[model samples]
Target: MMPCYSGYTKSGDKFFICGKLGPHCADARCMDVGTILCDYPVGDGKTCDMPICESHAFEAAPNVHYCPGHALMWRKFVDAGGVERDLKNVVPFAAKERT
Candidate 1:
């Protein structure tokens, strides 16, 4: 990820879409119509990513518009091996492309 990020750094902070979806992460990077905005990857550990710590999404209107991107920043944070440890290991972030 840092490799892609380094290239981006030279280009300035333009928006670049990144996702761990499909094979490596089996992540569904995009949403479809009728996806129910509040839906947060509901399924088994293989198919879905939501942890048991969360409650089901709301059924009513208004707040249900949030997608997982807008939800908690758990996946990447966890993948980075937790924030405190990441800093202690103390290396610059890497671009996955470079690796």
Candidate 2:
């Protein structure tokens, strides 16, 4: 079984966390394939907005949202005026686009 982090959403939703799969890594490339749930619902109260995992979570700076891969890249993006909050709403950019 894949490793995961369990937690509650702001609205009190439970979920199992996994890496955000897509092309936003160190090399502007991503290797995660198939369907991996970056933010998966568990108890189904509302929906957890945080996507966190021990093996995949990376803190770009302090208090910044956890990134799946390429933490530095993400930090740079945020520093360059990117929206930090958006990371939680739309990770694995491709996945968000699909849905």
Candidate 3:
């Protein structure tokens, strides 16, 4: 009538639970194995936003992430005189984009 645990380790009198047991991508739609951190922080400010596989990881700005499709879209946006807004407060594109 006792439950069994696989990742639990007992050292002396203390027990520790192993973190992640397997590899998983941060993007819910992705099926590829994760290999890199997106480098963008989530709202919690403690963990990276996306754990992407090599194929999905787009190097937009050195260490930043934008995905392959998004990278191209971002380039077009910048080319049209659009600037990246602050993460804390996002404004309308019409107001932020330069003519």
lDDT of each: 0.36, 0.44, 0.54
Instruction: Give TM-scores for every candidate, taking all chains together and pairing residue i with residue i.
Output: 0.17, 0.22, 0.38
Writing each residue's lDDT as its tens digit, candidate 3 over 1-99 gives 322213212342433233453454555665545557666444667535456665567777766775545556767877776764534377557755678
**Which pairs clash (backbone N, Cα, C closer than 3 Å) in model 1?**
1-95, 1-96, 2-94, 2-95, 2-96, 3-95, 21-27, 22-27
Residue 94 lDDT in model 1? 78
Q: For residue 22, what is the lDDT in candidate 2?
A: 32
Cand. 1 Cα-lDDT: 0.36
Clashes of 2: 0
Model 3, residue 13: displacement in angstroms?
Answer: 48
lDDT accuracy of residue 17 in candidate 3: 31
Where does candidate 3 have its weakest 10-residue lDDT segment? 1-10
- For candidate 3, the C-alpha RMSD (Å) to the true structure equals 12.9
Best by TM-score: 3
The sequence of per-residue lDDT tens digits that candidate 1 reaches over residues 1-99 is 621111123345433433532222112432211223344445563223332111222322354332345345445665667867767888788778765
Displacement of the residue 89 alpha carbon in candidate 3, Å: 17
TM-score of 1: 0.17
CA RMSD of each candidate after superposition: 18.0, 16.0, 12.9
Q: lDDT (0-100) at residue 91 of candidate 1?
A: 73
**Number of clashes recorded per candidate:** 8, 0, 0
Q: How do the residues 1-99 of candidate 2 rate in per-residue lDDT, one tens digit apiece? A: 543334445586765556544322221233223222233222655322333433355644454344444455666777876775666588464544565
